[model samples]
Target chain A: MSVVARLDEARAARRQKALIAFNATTLRLGGKTIIENLDLEVRPGEFLCIVGASGCGKTTALRLAAGLYGPTSGAVTFDGEPITGPRREVAIVFQDYGKALLPWRTAAGNISLALEASRVPARERSSRIEALLRKVGLPGHADKYPTEMSGGMQQRLQIARCLAQEPTTLLMDEPFGALDAMTRQGLQDEVLSLTQTSQTTVIFVTHDLDEAIYLGDRIVGLLPHPGRIGIELAVDLPRPRDQLATREHPEFLRLRRQLFDFIKATEH
Target chain B: MNRAAILWRVASILVAAGFIAAWQLIANLRLVSPVFLPGPDRAWAALVRGFSSGDLASKLIGTLEHMAYGWLAASIAGIALGALIGSSRMMRAYVAPSLEFLRPLPVSAIIPVAIAMLGLTQGMALFVIAFGAIWPIMLATIHGFAAVEPRLYEVARSLQMSRAAVIGRIALPSALPDILAGMRLSLTVALILSVVCEILAGLDGLGQWVLLSARAFRSADLFAGVILLGATGYLTSIAVSLVEQRLLAWQTAAR
Candidate 1:
């Protein structure tokens, strides 16, 4: 075998070890099928994006991985064990930043909540909170309440709080959809770099075509009506994705076009 | 302060002065009999006399003491019961109907029953005030708890908070603004009930003082007692608002 082919094979083997797996999962809510016979694997330290039109259960899949919902059949496993409930090793960043944060807590107080939940010692919390806030581009916002921040800042605060959990995997449900285009793009890049640096596995759900392409190392598209995976594309673009060059890359454009057509067809 | 705020404060003081002037004029002109409506001078004399005689002070103290004890008891009980009812669907369902049934019953009407059971004592007056005041506190608490954002609950659960921690940290703080609002309303209700209890039971309080002065044809003393009650209510509400401000400064800063 060629040397390049051998390297590809080794990389694929490492991915197969898997950080999270949804095995033959089906979910029924109120006598209606929401998702059916779904099987997917998320590798450790990989960015996986799930994209679909509305009602395609993209968020449902993320929730399953987050252990917020239990499948009616089959099981979701994390690191080789079936997930019975939300674990400290897994944290979620929700889309509705306004509703997700405690209005009564300042930015630092909110991050402190996660630390307190994890039983981190009080003496160590201030420095950790300071570091997490700084990491999220909110260095001096400790005394500011969630209501005092802009939508993007609140979203950043949410991300910072999730990071305080120090989770191995981060599950995000359309977290950037609520922001404006510029803010969304900025956060998308921020999240990308942060996750890469932390080596954190991520399962991000979004309906935006470009967002899925821009962020995911691998993208999975789902079809509605008993939502199931319809298309899977590996993003072979090089590391450190540049906003301008990555979008201009022929591979990125090709994936974008394919996913756009797939969504257009499935949306009907 | 800003110019507008300063102007409004001046305007308020002027309006109050104008009202007193009108009251003095009306009394001087004998627009209404002094027996029915005492003038400002008569009322002021009554105030000085009552304070000097110590009749008003002891009565005021008595009324305040009863309200303080009853309100404290009701607040503790209301918050505890409301939290329980708010958190559990089963408890809320079972308890809600009975609360709804009793809620509309006039508190004044219950004073007679309290009088019969506890027999015209301070305890009876306290029982009446506590019963009357608890409903608002509990209902406001229930509303606050129910109004808590579902996403916040999910966040707490995701953080793996214990049920106790969720209640103490998340649920309680989220429900506070509403609870504090309830406490304010309940404080007024407690004051009202205290006077009503005093009047009905002939207890040694501001209400009884007013009742006796009226019976003895001393309208000035009656007017003085009424002014004192109004002042007490206003001061209590202001105190509550100050505390609410301190606790919920985060909410204000957000706005």
Candidate 2:
């Protein structure tokens, strides 16, 4: 069998297991309900996208999955175990890449942070960092600091740092929200391919409806004012989605229109 | 370097030379008494004589030693206490009021108390100097650590870093620019307090030398001592800036 076929077989086997689940999860902050009765389950290797209007607690939901925040009323679990805090097995990509990365550290040094935390031997770290940097399309730019890199490059470096963890699940909070449209499209394809090869489960949050349809196997639209799931759609677009062709696909447009109308209704 | 920089350097040199020439002219015309306001020549001659035949070298060394010891003590204590206080909201809440009250109290006001507690010894001088110098370093460290980006801590959490590692690897480096700035300010405070302590405690330093020279009406020796102190301050500050430039090379490059 081909490498891709064997990987697909492995991913199919893993899909039987639920990697992360939120059972009636509700979160309250500052005497205000941010997320109310959020019920979600992400199967292993599934690309799940949460699309919503502003104040819809999409980022907050991603935080719950990352164990950066705990649900106030219900349980958030990973691998059938309750998530009290962040584990090394899950990694996050923040939208504000500038603030997310360490300004003092070079790209290589930032990637090394994960390796160091995982207790990867110092001798093994350089090669792993180089490989991860190459994987994220940042080859030979290790010594560049975050401030020295452009916005897209910095975001790529952040992704490289996350990939260094070799995480089973990637939680992204609008990772490309700050980028230009061209860069955003490039990164969207990159993330899709990276997750495909690794079969990493992803919970990507964004307000952009087209981005949601383009990247996710399943998309969940959220309503604001005590954020909760309002619309759920299964994307039937063909595999290895192309920016132009996949977006032009009739199913993709239909899903986009549905999400757009859902968001517009939520605003009213 | 560039034309503007070279021009500025020349302007500074000209101003210094003109001031020296004006002083010489005043001394030559006896606008002021020669005993009270000697020419730059007399002061230079006295400086050379002090270093060559007099005990000024040892006095200079003594003052430097006192300042170094005090500054070192202050830096360690300040960083330790600042980190402890800054890292915890509870500790900050409990200690902040007392720190605010103590912060504004003059270092000079405590000299007599320090002298009474420790006597007129090197220990007392060291204590007074360290006490005086520690505030800037500690306060700056507190501000630096407190002002760290909240998102960095979230990143640390996501990484599953230990609490100690979070502080050491993340907070310390993040707060470094502030700490270095504080240390630079404290260095000046340390030097000033060292001189004051020496003069008060009758310790063997440039401060004592200056006090004795003034009392004995040796204006040239007094002026020489003051000039040496000024030179010491200038050189030490430059040394600190060099260190800051090296450690915070990333900050400069980011800009």
Candidate 3:
């Protein structure tokens, strides 16, 4: 079956409840409250962008949603089930900037590793690996190592690896922060087009306000230290976004400035 | 051919021969007794005599047997103990200090205790050689385990690999360079200890041949045995280095 069909089948089975919910949650690390009493939800097929300064627990919130960590006193749930650990339904792209690939394995093998773990049929794995690599604009680079690839290419390979699971929700933690400004824009557009085409739920975290406004269906602005939702703004721009025109649109620029002003004014 | 380079090489060897000839002539002129010194030709004659008698063959074979057996035992024990220490955090913590303390003690010192316990036998000698040889391999494994980048471990985790799988697939392959380097180091020391055991213990090996020649005042025999020992040491080291290169080709390719 195709990835969309398989994901649709999975989501169809779990459609009665929200895909993710964080209910009055708090996360404590070494007895320091990082994020406290934060309530959040990611509906199916929603492109949610989380924006905050460094150390604002934006990444913490993403980790909590991805089931990498648990709330200290509250709940982080997927399909109304409390998440104890990472599962196949959710995959994370860490901000560690694409160094997460096994150097021993080529790009094709690295992308196919998850499928191997999931016990996907050996007869069909090659095609899926190829399709995922192609989907991420890395069709002919499958034999290269992560080290051989550039920052943008490595991130794209990580994307392919993430997509190998055909996950229902993608948790991207500053995934493009290391890329150049131009490459970042191009990748943001690719992310927008991919999400819109596939109807996959994405919880993207980024430092740039312009990036959030350019790609988000809804921008989740977070304040520093015990991070909570500082402001939630909806970007009404049409999907299948072109970077130049969409970014130049009056609504896009105005929304970018307003979020920047909000972030600037709200932090202590 | 590079004519000038070849000429220079020939000149250097001739210079070396001249120095040796001067030493031989000076010694023969009563500057030093012939019993205390032998020329190159005398050393060659002694080598031929030992070979024709068929004793050197058996002695060489015996020495090789000890070296091979001891090396095998040391490698297996070292890898196992290294894996155990490298794999477990608590075991590593408790074991680290003791390994540090024991690794520096001289291998020859253990000979007296070994002889006291097991008597003058190849078993005791082999055991001592293996014991001394193990620390390099163990430390290689430990340094490799400790020095592996945290990024690589996280990559293994993200790949959903099992812990044992990580060690087998990533850790060993990554640690191979250091492990081979350690093996090279330990092999040299093992050779020396083998000779030391043979000499001090006066067992029927090349070391015994050297002592016998010395006591009999046969300078040529002493030089012959010494040359053979040097050749064996040099040849064994070169062979191990070649094996190391083959075993660690992937590391060089990565670089």
Query: Model 3 off-target regions past 4 Å?
Result: A1-16, A112-116, A119-132, A139-143, A192-196, A266-268, B1-58, B202-205, B232-255
Q: In model 1 chain A, which range of ten residues has the least summed lDDT?
A: A1-10
Candidate 3 per-residue C-alpha lDDT over A1-268 given as tens digits, one digit per residue, 9 for 90 to 100: 4435644554464455678888899999998889988987778888889998777899999878866677898899888899887777687887775457766567897887778767788989889998998898999988887777788988888888888877888889899988998888878877777777888899999988888888787788888877888877767777667778888998888788889898888766
Winner of 1 and 3 under DockQ? 1
Each model's fnat? Answer: 0.85, 0.77, 0.17
- Lowest summed lDDT window (length 10), candidate 2 chain B: B246-255
lDDT for each residue of candidate 2 in A6-68, tens digit (9 for 90 to 100):
446544644576789889999999999999998888898899999988999999999999998
Looking at model 3, give its docking quality level.
acceptable
Give the chain B TM-score for each candidate: 0.96, 0.97, 0.87
CA error at residue A16 for candidate 1, angstroms: 3.3
Candidate 1 local lDDT, A65-86, one digit each (tens): 8888999999899999998889
Model 3 lDDT, residue A33, Cα: 88
TM-scores of the models, in the order given: 0.96, 0.96, 0.82
Ranking by DockQ: 1, 2, 3
Count of clashes in candidate 1: 0
lDDT of each: 0.92, 0.91, 0.81
> lDDT tens digits, residues B167-206, model 1?
9889999999999999999999999999988898899899
